[model samples]
Target chain A: MIRLEQVSVFFGPTIALDGLDTTIEPGITGLFGPNGSGKSTLLRVVAGLLAPNAGRVTFEGSPVATSDEGFVRRVGYAGHSAGLYSRLTVRENLELFAVLHGRVRPDLEPLLEQIGLAEHSATRAGVLSAGLKQRAAVARALVHSPDVLLLDEPYANLDDEAAALVSCAIQEWWTPQRIALVATHGAKKLKAFAHGGLILKRGRTVVQGSYRERPEAETFS
Target chain B: MSGVGFVAKTAALTRKDLRVEARSRDTLPPMLAFAFTVALVLAFTLPDATRASAKVVAGFLWITVLFAGLIGFARTFEVEREEGALDALLLVPLDRSGIFFSKAAANLVFLALVEVFLVPVFGLFFSLDLSSWLMLALVVVLVDIGFVAVGTLFASLASQTRSRELILPILALPVLVPAFIAGVELSADLFAGAGLDDIAARGWFGILLFFDAVFLVVGALGFEFAID
Candidate 1:
């Protein structure tokens, strides 16, 4: 389990996460929050990308997410804006990231096929459609096979069929040993696929636990 | 997160950057064009006597490089800063210091290529001899190492700001002063007919060497904080 204790993140004078405390358990969990509700910030903190101003983020009861150790081997992340090198083909981007993650010559064909980008792997990320790019971004995150998969708005641009395919892929990859957190504003199928959910309002947990009850959280859950 | 040693990590980073540059053509072309244009303008604009003076000619060459480099330097981290690619880079497991060194290495590669075209044209326009081109290249490369070492650091830092193009020069130029001074001095002596040995005897070369070493180390260590 990942425990967040009084974590707060300040951007200049504005607060992004305000003394928030929560636990991210092992299993696929839906993260639902309205715009500017700190969904992305929370994922970043968990991924070890952004360091919180105060409090601790612990994984398995050990403090992390605030060091230069590249404390991210176990965590996979795809942010709100998909981060891919536009000039590179989807294949090259996946291969490059795999090398950086220290997995030499990784076999990415299966992951690419699973994400539904097997044929489009040769297409430059800049030229790919928004939905295709989103697919590629998902594949990029999974290339390292991280145990903790944290995807922010992975279904934003995907169509119904594509969303369903991605959801199925996510479900197939997630196991009890893994922690899967997908933040979404839409896509009910993906939300329904999640076992539980968390909600944030201006960076504080307004409600969390089984979110299938609330209609709004129902879609992202 | 297997341990890829320093050299392997640096090579991987550089390879990624070089492929992007080779395809996108975002950085090198503008820098080379600006360097040549400035040299041509100077060739026509300067009085014959001033152009003939070794120190003045050396100053013009160094100044042109410094200004033209600004164009390339501003865009060195363009790939990383765009979208959320920097976060992806930070996610990968490696010694973070390798990021800084790789950036410096990539910038050095671009600037050195610019000089390949730049020095010949500079020598021709300013009526300088190409006989000691080897010595001149050595001096320019030393300056290039120091320049890119500091330039890559400042560029990465400035890229985080709202107005990065304006911020890069402000952050980099001050720290680069001593190296620029040493570069011009060493090159001027070479153009003034001093051999490499003679220039070494004066000890200004030490300043260039030390400046390169100090900033290269500082840039690597301080880079983690700069990005954070």
Candidate 2:
């Protein structure tokens, strides 16, 4: 489980995350918010990328710090930007991450196949369409088989086929033993998949419930 | 997931950099081209008398290497920045020191490759003896290590800022003054036929070593904060 206790983040004078508190259980949780509503900031904080000023983010019972090797290894984060080496081939990119994550003789063929990049495994990421690049990013994030996966706008620029590929990948990977939090503006797409979700306004959680019980479910259309 | 050992991580990162450079040719060719161009321009500017002086030749050669290295450092983190790959790098469980050292090692290799052509061309242009050429190689290796040790740290820091092009030199050049002075002084002594036994040459070499040790430590310890 992941828990944020009175978490607050500041970017200069701007309050990116207010004194927000929430608990995220295992399984996929759709993170919905308008632009500038702290969705990315919240995900970054959970991923141990950004440190909150006034609160604590804990995985299980331990605090999440970038310096903590054990904690970091359990987390996988894919930001809005693909976070891939444009110059690297898809296979090389996955292999690099796998090696870094300490997989001796890492088997990347399955991941490439699952992400629908096996055909373009040798192609450089820079030349791929935006949707393909996003798929590569997702594959890289899962190379380690992390326990906590945080994806920020994973389906943003993907085509219908590409989005379906992502949704399938997420469903296959996000088991009960793992926690996956996906942030997206399109709640309708997530309504069919997410078990629960949190809606952020400004820097605070305005609503928290199952998708069907959400007050803004009508607006999801 | 179990994390890779420090040595393994560092080697993997170094190999990744070399592979990327080999395919993309994003860093080395431009660096070599710029260094060669600088050598040509400087060669033309020198008069016959000045060209014959080993001191003048050594000074100009080090200057050319320094500027060429600056160009290389400017692009060190550029590819990562473009795709937000640095965030992924940070996500790796390896120690931040490993990241710093690997990057410095890669930069050192790139600088040394440029020197493979650069030193020979410099020797040919100046008509330097073979013995001086030997000492010049040693100087280049030491000087390049010192340059990349500090350059990698500043490049990583400057890359986080919006004006990375303007910020890298600003952050790096000031800290590199001592190394620059030592490189020029040592190169001049080597070209003047001073062996390692010469006190002047040995003293400048010591200064260069000190600079390398200091900056390497600083870069290893400070890299986490710089990227954070």
Candidate 3:
């Protein structure tokens, strides 16, 4: 389990995350919010990309900081930007990430096929289509088999087929021992697949429960 | 990530950068173009290349390299900034300082390649004596360490700001004065056909060695926080 306690992040006068407190259990949790709602900030804090200004985020039982090697190893993230080296081919990018994760040159052919990038493996990430780049990023995140997955808007540009491929990949990757926090505005498939949801407004949690109890994006505001 | 040792990580990152550069041909080509243009203009404009003062030749040669290095330094970090790829690297569990060192190492290699073309152009164009050109090469190698050390750090820091192209030179120049002075002073004597013993007597060698060491230490320690 990952627990956030009084976590606050301030960007000068703007409050990005306002003293958020929550506990995320072992399963996929949908993180929902409208524009400027701080969904990304909360995920960044949990993923140890940005340290909270005022509070502590603990994974399992230990505090998480950007410097914490264990927390970093445990988390895999696909940000809003498709974070692949533009000059590297999709295969090379995945291989590089594998090496960075301390694995030997991996046979990522299976993963490439899973993400529907097998045909585009030799293509440089810079010139890949938007949907393919997003898929490549998702594959890069999963290459290390991280115990905690923090995916931000994974379905933003993907078409129906690509979205289903990614959804299947994520669902298959999640096990009882792992926890995944997926931050998106609203997707029916993601809503159905997620075990629970946390909706935020201006960085503070506005609601937390099963989908039926949670308000839709339009009604929540 | 824990078991990935520092040496392996650094080597991997450096190799990846070089491989990408080799295929993309992005950073080096433009850098080479810029450096050679400086050499071309100097070669033609001077009344007589060989008759030019050692100070003028030396100053221009090093100045050409210094300005061209700015291009290479910025380009080296451009790979990391694309599509927020830098955040992905940071998310890895390795010590963040390794990122700084790898980047500096790669920038040093890029600058060295530029000089490979640049030094020869200066020597041929100016008709300088090559008997002691090796001594001049030593000065360049020594001073470039300090140049790249601070250049890589400041490049990363300035990358965060809005006006990075304008900000890089401004942030990096003040700290680089000592290396610039050392490179020019040592190279002038070498260009004038002075041997190592004679060049060493001038004491710019000491300044350069000390400056390189200090900048290297500062870069390694401050790099992680600089990006933060």
Best by lDDT: 3
lDDT ranking, best first: 3, 2, 1
Against the hidden reference, what TM-scores do the models get?
Answer: 0.94, 0.94, 0.94
Q: List the residue pairs that clash in candidate 1.
A: A191-A221
| Candidate 1 lDDT, B41-76, residue by residue in tens | 888888783357888888888998897887898997
DockQ of each: 0.58, 0.70, 0.59
Give one digit per residue, the lDDT tens place, for model 2 in A114-216.
Answer: 7789999999988989888888998889999999999999888887778888888888888888998999876767667877888898899988766556656
User: Relative to the unseen true structure, what is the Cα RMSD of model 2?
Assistant: 2.3
Q: What lDDT is reached at residue A95 by model 2?
A: 88
What would the per-residue lDDT of candidate 1 be over residues A12-78, giving only the tens digit for each residue? 9888999999998888888888888888899888887888999889888777653435457777889
Evaluated on CA atoms against the true complex, candidate 1 attains a DockQ of 0.58
Best-performing candidate as measured by DockQ: 2
lDDT of 3: 0.86
What's the CA error at residue A66 for candidate 2, in Å? 2.1
> Which sections of candidate 2 miss by over 4 Å?
A211-221, B1-3, B49-51, B199-202
DockQ of 2: 0.70
> lDDT for every model?
0.84, 0.85, 0.86
